[model samples]
Target: MKLASFRSSIESEIRLGIIVDDVIIDMESWGIEHDLDLPSTMLEFIDLGPAAVKAVSETLKNIDARSLVATSIPLSSAIITAPIPAPRKNIFGIGLNYTEHVAESARTLDTSKELPQQCVIFSKPPTTVIGPGDSIKHNDQVTKQMDWEGELAVIMGKKATHVSKENALDYVFGYTIINDISARDCRRSGQWIVSKGQDTFAPMGPYVITTDELTDPHNLQIITKVNGVEKQNGNTKFMLFNVNDIIEDISEVISLEAGDIIATGTPAGVGAGREPQEFMWPGDVVEITIDKLGTLKNYIVKA
Candidate 1:
């Protein structure tokens, strides 16, 4: 099922919605009309787990637009928000997890680092996340070297601890697109927290697809475009450590609760990794798309 968080122009309230082709079913108002209490926010819906999903599924299956009394509207008329607009915790990220991207980033230094023997992880503050069509902050004085990292992000459905690669996929709720927008200049020293956690750096969503919708998470065509030009064209199949490995590795240390986000690493074609180097400027548009998951697009604007 394709799910979303959106605000209706009439009510102007953030609410949970389920997508059905060209229209979005407003769950919050629908519950009031039908007298069936439903989740109002994406996080609440996720926290409710399978039951919430089942309820929405059943509603969609039985719902007939021709005789409906629920609040349904065209998708184009709603203001879409990140599937998980405000996460409970900072977003977790995997860095240098892609062999090709690792190789490109390693060229600037003489560290002679081989392929990572273990998972390299980092976190981005929740404040960094914005929905698709939102504007990315380009603070010229703060960070002149802004770049984009298109990635497929995973959303956890259950509380996971010490899980194995074999069962990691079972814990996933769904997937979405994330433009891991970066401030290269903020890579001050070797830490990536601040560099990647700046406000409006994580432009995610289009909508979250339930795990059942995607046939294979590990094998999807992921692409990134800057101002209508494709710059990074790669597949998820090339990742050095796939999604299963990422889940197991993190869970081994701490529990991953429901509603948590995990952004799988990006491919090799980042601006900073280019020979002459490239960076985003004001008014530039960045878009990221993963098969099954919808495309996430955002524009750069002066902070």
Candidate 2:
């Protein structure tokens, strides 16, 4: 099932809904009217476990067609927000998870730095998340080098700790697209939180697709574009540390809850890794698309 978080044309409240073909039906409203138990937010809905999945599927399958149309609103008529509007925990990210990106970084940053042998983890506060088509803001007072990292984001369905790679995918709820925007100048030294955790740096969503719909996460194509020109074109098969590896490694020490997002990291070809280096400026549009998962588009703007 494809799910989205949206609001009416005039409202600011975010509500969960199901995307039927091209149209989006307000699931919360339908559940309430039909006397079916349903959570209003995506995070809470996910916490309900397999029962919630069954409920959502049955609701969509049995709802009145005419009533659904009458009460439903066109997707273009509403505002789409990040799937997890209020992430209870910081968004987890991996750095240099692709060999090509690692090689590029070594050449651009430091030739002496050694290749990574373990998972490189980072995080961004929930405030950084913006939705598709939202404007990405950069503060000149903060950082002049604003870059983009197109990634495949995984949404967890249940609490996991010490899970093995062979069974890590079982904890996954769904997948979505995220552009991990970075403020390259913010991290003068030390860990990369400040450089990566800036507001509007995490443009996610369009929709979250359940794993049942996507059986193979490791064999998808990932493409990134700036102003309609291709910048990064890679495949998931090249990931240095696959999704299962990251999940098992992280969960072995830290507990991952339902709704927690793991941005599996970006591939090579980011602006920082290019000749003469090209960073984002105001009025620039950035888009990231993954096979089956859908496209996530956002624009760059000034503060």
Candidate 3:
């Protein structure tokens, strides 16, 4: 099911919903009307693990079209928010995990040309996250070289520590799209916190698609466009380190909690990697799309 966190255009309260085609079935309203004990928010629902999935499944099965229309909000009219608006901790990011991206980084930026033997990890603070249709701050004072990296983000369902690659996927709650926006010049001291962790740097959501729906995460297509011009076009199959490798590698060192997000690296064709380096400017719009996972669109605005 396509699960989402959204707000009604007429209200400020954030609510969870299930997307059926273009309409959003307000889970909170449905639960209340049916007397089902459903969690109020996406985070709470994720923490419930399989039980929550089961509950939602049952809800989908029992919900009829007439009832759906009465309680549902038009997805086009709702304000889609980040699947986890305020993450419990920084989001885990993988760097140079795509062979072509590694090569591009080596040519345009100060990144290693050699492929990583293990996952290269970094963290993006929760403040960096914004939902679909939001704006990405192009603060010239902060960064003159603003770039985009389209990636697949993983959402964990439960706590996982020292999990094996074979079992790593068992902890996943769902998958979502993330535009890992970066400030190319801010990789000072070879660190990304200042470069990639700025507010509005991460454009995520549209909604989260549960694991059962998208069984093969690595086979999806990831594309990014700037102002309607295609900039980055690649596929998840190009990932140097797959999702399982990333989860197992990270879990060996740090515990991954429920609702924790991991941006599983991006494919090639970043602006910085072009023949003449390209960057986003105020008024620019970026749209990232991944197969199975819907497109996430954001506008670049002056900060």
Candidate 4:
């Protein structure tokens, strides 16, 4: 199921829903009508774990699409928000996980050419997150070189610590799309918090596809475009350190709880890696599409 967090209007409270045939079946409304225990927010639903998912599945099995459409709101009428509008903590980010991306970074950013033996991890504060169609703030005083990195993000379903690669995936809740917006010139002493953790720097969500629906996340195609021009096109199959490696590595040090997000890094063709160096300016629209996961689109705007 494609799960989302949205509101009927800009001033309305956020609610959780399931997207079906481009319509949003308001879970709270449905639950109230049917006397089912369903959550109103994405985080609350995720924390409810498999029981909540099972309840949704069972309900869907008994209902017809017509009933769902009749009671649901048109997706166009809903104000879609980030699947998890406010994460419990900072989002985990992997750096240089793709072979080609690493090479490109080395050439343009003067970084190491060889791939790391382990996952190179970082974090972006929750303040960076914004929903689809939200504006990516472009503060001139903060950064002049604004770039995009389209990546597949993993959402953890359960608490995991020291998990093995073989069992890492068992703890996954689902996957979603994330545009890792960055301010190239804001890096301070190799740290990314200032560069990538700025407000509205992480635009995420069309919706989250549950693990059962998106069975093979490691082989999906990822593409990014700016102003209708293709800038980055790569596949998840090329990830040097795949999802399992990342989960296991991170879990060894820090426990990953339910609803925690980990962006699995991007492929090559970032603006900073180009020969002439390209950067996004105000009014530029960026769209990132990943197989199984829907498109996450946002526009750049002056702060």
State in Å the error of residue 152, model 3.
0.3
The residue-by-residue lDDT of candidate 1 on 86-113, one tens digit each, is 8999899988877878887888522235
The parts of candidate 4 lying over 4 Å away from their true place are: 65-70
**Candidate 4 collision pairs:** none
Candidate 2 on 240-296: residue-level lDDT in tens? 889999999999889999989999999999988899888899989999999987889
Write down the worst ten-residue block by lDDT for model 3. 31-40
lDDT of 1: 0.86
Roughly what TM-score does model 4 have, to 2 decimal places?
0.97
Which pairs of residues have clashing backbones in candidate 2?
none
lDDT of residue 253 for candidate 2: 86
Q: Weakest 10 consecutive residues, lDDT, candidate 2?
A: 109-118
What clash count goes with each model?
0, 0, 0, 0
Give lDDT: candidate 4, residue 30. 81
Model 2 score (lDDT):
0.87
**What TM-score does candidate 2 get on C-alpha atoms?**
0.95
RMSD for each model, in Å, please?
A: 1.8, 1.6, 1.2, 1.2
Tens digits of per-residue lDDT, candidate 3, 1-303, equal: 899999987467888988988899888777777777777799988988977787778768777778777778898888899888899899999999889899999998977889899999999999999998888988898899999999999999999999999998999999999999999999988988899999999889988999878778889999899999998888888888899999999999999999999999988889899989999999999999999888999999999
- List runs of model 3 lying over 4 Å from the truth: none
